[model samples]
Target: MKDQGLSYRLTAGLEGYLDPADALVTALAHGGGADNERCLKRVTAHLKADVKEVSAFLGLVRIRELPRREDIELRNTAFLHELGPSLTGAEITGLYTELVRRTREAMQGRLGPRWAEQLAVHDLPTKLLRKRIGPSTVADLQQRLLRPDHVLLTDVSQRLSGVETALVRKLRRGAATDDVIQEAQMVRAHADIHRMKQQSLGTWPADPAIEADLDERLLLVARRTIRSHATDPRPANAIFDGLQTTLETSAATHDRWPLYARDSVLLMGRACAISDECRFDWGTAHESPA
Candidate 1:
C-alpha cells in the first residue's frame, strides 16, 4: 500500500512537470524550425537537465521521507545546522529575489496581455513575490489565475464563507460583553462589503448603483453599532472610536476602508479576548469578576 501511494504521488508530480515541459518543448519546436539541428540539440539538453534535477530532488525526498515522520523538528534542526556554515541569510534572500524576477519575466513572456490584465486587477507581482513560489510552478499558477473556472470561484467563495461563519460563531459565544459582539459584527460587515466590492470589480459593467447601496448600508451599520456602544466602558470601545474617526475623516470613496475595516476587526477581536482573559484571571485570583 505504501509503495502504491508513493507511486501515485510520483506519477502526479511527473504529470505536473510533464504538461509544462511538453508545452515549453512544443513552443521551442514551433519557434525554431523543425529541421534546425541546433533547436533539436537544445531540446535534448533541456530534457536531460530536467530529468537529472527531478531525479536528484526525488532522491532527497526519499531520504527525508522516513525521518520527517519520526522527528520533523530534529531533522529540520540538523539540516539547518548543516547549512549554517555555508548558507548565509543574505544569500538565501538574493536567491529568492532572483527566482521571483525570473518567474515574473517568464509570466510576462508567456502571458503578455493576460498578465497585464491580472496586474490591473490586483497587485499580482507583489503577491507572487510575497508567496516566493518557484519559477517552475508559475506557468500552472498563471494559467489558473488568468482563467479561473467556476469550480475555483466556488471553492474560494465557500472557503471565505466558512471562515466568516466560524469567526461569527466564536465571537457570539466567546465575547464577554454585548459591546464586543456588536463592534466585532460591525467590522465583519465592513469586511464582507469590501470583499463584495472587490468581487464586483471582476464583473463587466458593474452596477455602480448597487455598490452605492451596499456602501450606504455598510455605513449605516457602522454608525448604528458605534452609537449603541459609545458609552460602553470596555477596552474595545477604543476600536469603535477609531472606526468612528475614520468614518468622519475619510472620504466616502477612499480605498482605506477595506484595510481599516480588516485591522479594526483584528484589534477588536484581540481586545475582546484579552478582556475575557482578564475577567477570568481576576475572578480566579480574587474570587470576584472585574
Candidate 2:
C-alpha cells in the first residue's frame, strides 16, 4: 500500500512536470535538434541524482518545469515593446500547462503562482528579479518585465499558489528563514490585492504608514504560515485557507469600527499584539485567540 501511494504521488508530480504544453514547447524549443539533447541530459541527470523516492524525483521535475522570469506578469504589466518575439502555439501551450500544473501544486499546499509573482516585485531585494518600473504600471509588455511562462493569466496574481509554501520537505532545516517569510508575504499580498480589486475602490488611502502597518501585520501571519510548515507542515494550504477566512471576515466587517471596522487591519498594527513568539510559536499564537 505504501508503495502504491508513493507511486501515485510520483505520477501526480509528473503530471505537473510533463504538462502537455510544456512537452510541446520543449519539443518545438529544440526544433528537432539540440533541445532534444538538453531534455535528454536533464533526464539523465535526474536518473543519476540521489532521489530517494518517486515523489522526490517527480517533485524535482515539477520544480524544473517552473518558469524563471525577472519581472512578473508581463501580459498584465508590459506586453508592448520588445522583450521577446511573439510566442508560437507551442510556446503558449507550454506556458499555460506549466502555470496550471503549478497552480494545482499550490492547491495541494505548495503556495501557488501568486507566490511566484510576489517574488518578482516584492519589497525585498534579491537576485530573483531586479528590474524596477519607474513608479508606473508596465501593462503586459516584454519591456522590463514579461509574463511568467507566457500564460494569459491576467485575472488573479496568485502565481505562486503552487510553490510559495514554506516546508522542510522543500529543503533541509537550514534553509533561509527570510526567504520563507518573503514568499509568505507574497501570498498574503496577492490575497489582499484580489480583495481590494474586487471591491474596485478608486482611492483606499494608500498611505505608506497605513500600507506598512498592513504589510507588517500580514507579514506576521505569513511568518506563522511558514512556521506551520516547520512542524507537521501543512503550511501553504493552511495559510491559504486561513487567508480566505480572514478576507471573508474583513469584507463583512469592512465598514464597522473597533468591533468590526474599516480602520482595523486584520493582522496588522494595533490589531493584535503579535510579538516574535506569537509570530512563530503556533502554540503561543493560538493560546489566546480572542
Q: CA RMSD for every model?
A: 23.0, 22.2
TM-score of 2: 0.23
Best by the lDDT measure:
1
lDDT of 1 by residue, 55-157 (tens): 3333322111122122333233222222232445454345445545765665554444566576566556654444344655555433423332322334333
Candidate 2 segments whose C-alpha is farther than 4 A from its true place: 1-201, 243-290
Residue lDDT tens for model 2, 93-183: 4554554455455445433457677665646443222233322323432332354545443322343343322221122222324554454
Worst 10 residues of 2 by lDDT: 9-18
Q: What is the TM-score of each candidate against the true structure?
A: 0.20, 0.23
Cα deviation of 15, candidate 1, in Å: 28
Instruction: Please estimate how well model 1 matches the true structure, expressed as its whole-model Cα lDDT.
Output: 0.39
Superpose all Cα atoms of candidate 2 onto the true structure and report the RMSD in Å to 1 decimal: 22.2
